[model samples]
Target: MIDEEYAKLLKQAELDYEDNKKFIMVLKKIRAKSLDREFNMLHDKAFEEIDCLKCGNCCRTVRPIYQQKDITKLAKRFHCRPIVWEKEYTDVDEDNDRIAKTVPCPFIAEDNYCIYYEDKPKFCRDYPYTDKTRLRNYLRETMENSKICPAVYLMINWLKESVNRGTLS
Candidate 1:
């Protein structure tokens, strides 16, 4: 079951995103001591409470881009040639990047489980891209992912609040 408070928090974050975005842009550019540490703390906290099994919006909504090297590995899982697997399972997006052919991903089970969870692509494993960073480079992607990853949505909102309150400095 979705945690009711987390659901409420995400709803508020989505509604507040546009209003909070300008500030988030500024926050993104600020390089401060322990900033990534602070962000990561919140990221870890959110993950503890928000279960992916309760929400697979990332898989249902966005396909992870598969780079060529990963494609060969992914294809091997099915015991197929990379070229054949790409033809059968993926297509090039507008960005000329390869992505899954289907929405609600062919690999995602009905109960929000990914059939490919163990051998999923790096991007799938790193969905929301929250862990690694140069925070400045991640600003745009962070904002976009906030809606999909509850952890991101919560962390960004908390960051905005802390920065505005002069507490995170």
Candidate 2:
């Protein structure tokens, strides 16, 4: 069953997306320190309230873009050649960069847990992309992610509320 709060948050996020593009653009240009402070504050508050493990929607639906470093590390951990691992578990994306081919990543177990949780890529470890360096593009990408990941929807809702309340202003 869908959590009612999740549904409400998703609706609010959609509404905010339509109504607050300007706010988003303006926030994108705000100083990195200010944005980081606000993002960290909001992230802490939202994480305290939302349990991602309960949903695991992001894990089930989205694939992180794996860097060469990530591939090398994972390959070493699995005791396999990077080329072999890439062939079996991933594919070249449009940019001809190696990325996971399947959603719910091949390494994620049936119980919705990561088999390589500790060794997961930095992008996976920092899913939803909240860093100030790519905050704007991340937010834009998150709008698409929201359709599949409840956590992204929740984060976007929380961000919208923070902006509305002037906490991020």
Candidate 3:
């Protein structure tokens, strides 16, 4: 069963996604430096205000791309062979990259805690990519991720406000 807060966040995320889509092309043209500074400032401020533990939405909805090194580390952690890990926990993406097959990462416990919190992949640790270097791509992906991540919703709202206030310019 989904947590109540998670459900609410998902609904709000869907709405935010629709609202933010109209700005994509314009956002794509934003200068990299400006976008980066704005993103960093916004990310810092937003994170200070929001608590991810209140809603571990990302862990509950998406898989992180796992590099070969990550696979090796995870396999070692589980005391399983790398090939066994690949067969049991992951699949090759369209690009032939190994990624978790299960959404809501298999390591997420029933209680919303990560079974491998300390050993989670780099992608998981740096999620909701907030750097301006990939703002266009981030926006595109975040819009889709809003279906399951409240952090995306919060980020979108922050972006909208920043844009309106001319801080993002």
TM-score of each: 0.87, 0.76, 0.85
The model with the greatest TM-score is 1
Question: Best lDDT goes to which candidate?
Answer: 1
Q: List the residue pairs that clash in candidate 1.
A: none
The true-versus-predicted C-alpha distance at residue 5 of model 2, in Å, is: 5.8
The list of candidate 3 runs beyond 4 A from truth reads 1-6
Over the stretch 85-113, how does candidate 3's per-residue lDDT look in tens digits?
Answer: 88999988889888889987879887677
Distance (Å) between predicted and true CA of 31, model 2?
4.7
TM-score, structure 2 vs. true: 0.76
Backbone clash tally (model 2) = 0
Writing each residue's lDDT as its tens digit, candidate 2 over 1-169 gives 3356755666666666654445567667666677767666666666677666555666766777788888888999989998877777788878877778898677777666778988888878887655445465565665665655556666666667777787766
**Model 1 root-mean-square deviation:** 2.2
lDDT of the candidates, in the order given? 0.78, 0.68, 0.75
Ranked by TM-score, the better of candidates 2 and 3 is 3
